[model samples]
Target: MALEQLSEVIQRCQALPENSYTSEDYDLFTVAGRTCIEEGNSLQLLSIVLDEKNQEIVQCMGWNLLPPLVQVLLKKENKDLPHCLAVFNHLIEVCRPKELLIGLLEQLEHDDPDTTAESLHVLLTPLQKLLNLGVRKASSLGMALSSVLEQLCKLPVPETTEQEQDDVFSLGQCCSELSAFIQPFVEEAQHNHIRGKDSAQMMGDLPHNEDELRTELLKCMQVLSRLLLGVQLRDMDTLPESPLRDFASSILIGDSLPALVHRPLLRHRHIPGFLEEEVRYPKESLACIAHLLFVHHLLADMFPTVYQELYEKTLVRVEDCGLPVDLLEIKSFLSVPQNLVKVMTICPHQNLRSKGLKVFQLSIDKFNTEAKYKFFLMLKTSNHSGVEGYIIKNIKNQIDSALKAEGGNVWFEGLHLLPLLRSVLMLPDGPETDLLQYMDIMESLNLLRYLVIRDKTGIWTELYKIEDTFLKPLRVGINMSRAHYERELLITKEDKKTKAKVSVGDEKLPNMTTDTHIKALHSALHTFDMIESVLVRIEELVD
Candidate 1:
């Protein structure tokens, strides 16, 4: 069904002429790319573009409207994969530097060869291509590029006035600067991959990987296309590669424009990464399952899928995971625990996968004598892993649940898992870590709230320590984030002398904006204040 629907859309996109598809259809294409998998065509269009590109249906289609489709498709890493390959294929088909040079040769041998001026314009075609390619694969291609520029610089230095000599040298100097400018990109590519919370993870960019290098070649194509915006490839090829080649032999021959040879090269900008992946949140975590008794089993019968895995399959515990603070409360459903607390957990009512990763940390050693007998049963019932930290966490949760249960005769929802709270707060974290799940903090603070209420005298000291140790570091992180964004906030200044301009959008930087960073900083600070306020209330109640 999905395949047929997608085929129909492709037929429509291809069957109709370019003018036939309206701007409304363009908007639908964007929506279809984002929602087809969820609502309409079930990703039928993406499959046609990927697996069936050679078919007659799309082969005749002129890809004029491809840019907008590409913009929406590149929002995530996985979604952008097919487009990445397509762009790579396009670049491979169009860029022929060797061919460009050969055409330059034809011009040098023409009957009325005006070698200098016309040949230099033709030379720009391949020079720009090489520059863009060097930007993409600078680490390995840098030396070869520097070598090419050196060859171009070998032209005879006319012993005329200094100004003429300066013109010739300027072109060589720009090429040399461009050659050395790719160092920053090479360094960034080598830094660790960002395993973001979003599903659209970045495609791996290993500089040494030949396959990755091939796809990345597309980055240069955009810049090259911009420079050659309206020029015809056939027309450029009619010119010659020679006058440049002949001039490079350290000899100044007759019948060539030395003036054109000395013309400054066109300055091209570096290709911006429009397809970089979105970052994920809450990097580290542990998963543990909740056990069910008779009443729980009965509830499970009502919504078998939801209750069966109520706390079974999808259980994740990280420092923080909630959305921005101003949204007020976590958009989750309330579920009761045993008698010690009323609301034990708040699980996702829909899209349980957003709860992040589903992991198995159950182990025989962690499951005490009470749960020890159920070891074989657990192995059969749940997906299990021997990951030591997760296993240790699982065992601690089991013990915490059992301890909470011993104090009451109610069925356990594993809500009063004290050890889980301690492990989360007392757990060692990186100095600048901010990717915490809000639920974790809420749960930990909730447990403290319950503790202080039940055993006020005994719990205050522990609560203070937890606040100092856990919440303090979080406060520090929030402040640092605020300070950082404050610097990022763009400040517009006016000058009386010349009226200087400072754009809010700095072309050199990406994801650096006053509003976005400020909002995030404000969000972090808000979450911190809420946590601190709760801690203060709990402390006062204990006192």
Candidate 2:
């Protein structure tokens, strides 16, 4: 009955003139097609559509027939898989790419895991085909590509052995497909933007206008960079193999761009624009790339040049114009943790550094446990005392949470946690260390104090090593800093009194107030006092 109904609909649809099918006819056709699909006669249903005599019927079915056919493709053991692929491929050739993409994307979004997985397995090839068509046809396909890629980026990464084993459509496969899809854009970009080829001479259909093509390329780069970021967050271990990484490397670190050469000095106003296009990539894209490089430690040679360029640009922005009102809100600026560290540690402008620190703290708080662990591992060797100290504070939070956790936190337990703690606890200069200079030492002292008081057995066994390396050096350093600050405080007071007496006759001369130097000395003294207090408590706990 379903096959007969489908045949009648097909005949009626074919007999009518093109653009002559009414809404009722499409509804009837949809019902017949879905019924035949449900009744296991999909091959019979598609055989007619696939016939050369019924080409108009195929066009008439248009995108409306996609749903039933997609249902067939997604079925696990459908006997009509070959016919379904043929019909779907035919639709790809004749139907509007946009409608086909939209329909398929909706099917991919099905809530059931099995269905979504099946859709990915079946639709990935067709989607790639559509992408090729869209690119070659010079269609307004960038918008659709962006939506689809962004959705794919959000696909949950398999984290556990079981989840990975169970994954029917893994992120790795999706990334591979996306990487292939991005290749044409990369080639066209290199050809047109870098090689100076005319758009007409380029392969496939792309926008003729150079700027339009550039805009599309940037969008692709941005999303691909974001996909790389997702790979980093889920499993940094897999990032080396990620096809996304390869494309990013080709664009950002390729020979076309002077990734290794030092950028010459430019006027402050031009810095923004220059960095935005340092290598034909926009600033946000560069930030994502820099972030990937920083995490991988792959930029010991090339990345420093880019960092220098950014430092020079940021210095100008902070000194000449001051921090922007939306500086913290800027994704490019906040994307890289190391960039924030640079701002907080070395930027000459105090206000900008302060804002940078605020954003840094907020950003650190936003990462999940696994990301935080990976981030901390990458940043612990930053060589900046304050940054390392800030990282130690976060590590302390993780350890504390793990101690109190009922089941234990995977990231904050076992051998990995021990090494991280040891790194944070070590003082390179030992007893002669300048506690005032290295905030990390102070944070380390606090973390040590907490561990001694909390984990008597786990961390206690390492106490001898901690005492020799961390506690002893910290003790000597704290005493040195305390004595130094106290003496400086006294000298400043004496100098202030002397200056006041001398300036009595010179009313025009400013009196000695608590100036910047005095305020800094007082703050140092307070820090020393806090360190001493924490040290004493730690000794009491350990003894």
Candidate 3:
């Protein structure tokens, strides 16, 4: 175990040819390996063995030294730690990259968290080096990267398991490694010249170029899509706090994600048509990106700068190519009405919200009666006044459509129509609710008025249920709100008069203005009065 033993192993290794080593030589080399840490000259020994002239030593005993080098690395106080790391780096060049990578991956599962973390942390350099190896020393790594992503997709979210701290640390490290692993290939693929036909090379060797890089990128994204598409970020704002929830929130609040996300849309002044093809590469990428932005609010920002940039960029491309995808439709996540509703409800941008509304209006009719019915129910739960109002209006439209001679009345007629009608007829938080805050109540009233006037025959059988379940409560609520607001209005007027008399000054202070307050109260009173009249008309029509 002395330095001389390592020296003897080195001398014996230098005298042998590649693949010509006997069992005796390997035995001697294994016997001398302990000196790497025991001699206190680990760095010097590592330096000597890493020399170009000692390829024989490295080829013969490089993997053999990995165990002891990691042992040295685990020693917090080891002075030769940095030297050991340098040797590990050199070992990557001499040993097969896959073998070195597999060794690191194995260490990541160690029962001791510190060991798992160090193993994960150390993976960064070797991964980068292995990726940088390109096709020179290895074939396409698309499959390997895919396998790694599959494993990452299975890592238990932090705080959900007994290993809370370990889970968080490991997940954080994995996210870092995931970012580092994909960035180079993503950045490289940004160039149009390197962009090739989109195909997923899931298995087998391919030439290292746009084809291979993109295959690797696609496989990784496919894994991510499987993991992410199954998640519902639509109600992330309401989700109970958890490590995964917190992580998703952090991503939403943070600045834009790196090239893996925005770069595809941001890089090109004008993207090709294939970017939106039905095929995999960009489609999977786009699907994941859209899911992140729409459902998870991953890219949503208060200022809309990121949304603005991406929207403008993609808009230009869409207009240029006449691509079927529209940013307005949120075409990526638009397949699900809930996702679109989530984006429209929570998006901060006024223009995007308006555009989303337009898209929702145009697309709502495209769904069958059943889907539209379900979507109406979904919108009611949004708790958003505009969304509620919009859905209520749609409910009225569907009933009107069913009444038309040519309209099939498939699911929007008779009993099928009652469920849709009931979804919009009820007051949110009951009639005593803040009517102004729940403007959708007026839309509900209008819908009721339309139904009573247009199709009372269809719903006559259910009128009692409607009145008892929806109208009676609404009537009580409206009356209560009316009296409450009238009292507030009377008090507000009296207060204003007193303030006017007390103010001896000619000019009024900004805070002294009660006109806006009075107008708000009058508006509330007017709304309640209008709702009462609708109730009266319905009662009269039924009588």
Candidate 4:
């Protein structure tokens, strides 16, 4: 109630042994144990405690003061928001001590006095109160939490360079404490924002929402993304297995990164008009999707699970997010066999895939021959049944491009995508739909034609394997095409007979020309002839 009483609590806190004190007692939810702010000197008491010049008094008051003050501040009265922010600023300053920050800046200027960065240990415990008070469920608490998060972003995170390639950043060290609280907001906000699109939105005009609650929530997500980026850049290449780097990743590489990655997809249009003008981490290319590209590269090698998840989500978002993941440039993300499966099954984005395969073909020499085996295993145990044929068709397109792309690279002699072709042609004898099986057979023959035409010597070099892989598919495609063509021809003839028998007057099929079985027969014959030519070329190369 008075300065003397505050001093006594401070003395007790100061006298405790290191590690003697417990975490904040969350039950202390009142202003000195009363709900009504009208009855206490809560504001005055906080101001006095904050003003105490003694470092020990301030540190002692910290664990006890803000957690309860926030209970009152988040009670939805407009009068209390400033008080909450003041308490928040006090705690942030206490943790990110001014002296510590000035010391970091001074070291940067001098670049001589080696100084260790401050640990954010002091802020972690008391700030856990926000976690206890779920921000999204309590609108008042969400507003207060948003204010605290914005202030956290404004603080400068300093960097220190140990070597030319090694730079460690400061605020990333604190993200672990903040990640849990921040992630919940992303899920709740995305849920609320995704409902109800009108005719205007369908026509590509912006969404309309009067609730400005999301502006702060969106700002928090952007801040969280940038904070995670700081954490990533701090320790990306840190010697494979260092505790410091690993600690930073534990926070940044959680569920948050994966969920936040879909931000551009879930919330791109919903971003309010005000935010569009001054977006901090603006959609340099579709916001979170673009940012996740950097995040994936930094953590993909160390955390394969992260890479797999990001790769899959990236597949779903390629069209909306503008195809930001470049697997060829970042070999680590695509190194896994399962990731290869994901790549093979991405159904949309033909142009992205086409460009990607060219890049991959150009870099085939950079990868070991082992990548070929991985792709073979992927297609052999192909998981995405719906899209594997499409994958096969696209690979032929790549092989054609590679054969067309003039280069003297040694890898060009061996198509990087050939193993996938092997797996496609070697499909098990099973009863899928006729159209599906026929499509698969045709894709194999077409790819084989391209291979035999461009690099007959390469095809012949693997002739023993190619015998089972190519010749069988060629036989199947030719036989199936003939059967299908003959059946359709008979059906058309029967239909004509039925129509003549009816003798209906002058409605002559509405002047529409037919796609006759003869046309299909011709196309099939052309494919069969090309495969035959490929076999001859292979024979010549072998001789």
Tens digits of per-residue lDDT, candidate 3, 1-543, equal: 466776786787677777888777776666676565655677777777667888766755666666677777666578888878788778778776555655655543455544544555555557667657645322335544644554556654443233433445466556556666666665665443223322324444442333334433545555445544433332434443334434434332322345344545322222233232221435555565655564455546532434422333334333221333232256454445566676688876555567677656656655556666666675687888988888888877777777884557567677677776777777657656677788887788777777778764377878888888778888888878888889998988998877766644776544346878889889888878887887888899889
Better of 3 and 4 by lDDT: 3
C-alpha TM-score for every candidate = 0.25, 0.49, 0.43, 0.32
- Misplaced by over 4 Å in model 1 are 1-421, 430-432, 435-439, 456-468, 471-515
Question: Residue 9 deviation, candidate 1, in Å?
Answer: 48
- Output the better candidate (1/3) by TM-score: 3
Ranking by TM-score: 2, 3, 4, 1
Report how far off residue 336 is in candidate 1 (Å): 26
Positional deviation of residue 385's Cα in model 1 after best superposition, in angstroms: 18
Model 1 lDDT tens row, 149-249: 33333333322233233434333333333333333333333332122212223444433212233223223222112211211111113333322122221
Which numbered prediction scores highest in lDDT against the true structure?
2
- What would the per-residue lDDT of candidate 4 be over residues 437-505, giving only the tens digit for each residue? 344555555566566666632665666787765565555655675577667767766666555555348
Summing lDDT over every window of 10 consecutive residues in candidate 1, give the lowest-scoring window. 280-289
**Angstrom error at residue 98, model 1:** 39
Pairing residues by index, what is the TM-score of model 4? 0.32
Q: After TM-score superposition, what is the CA distance of residue 49 in candidate 1 from its true location, in Å?
A: 37
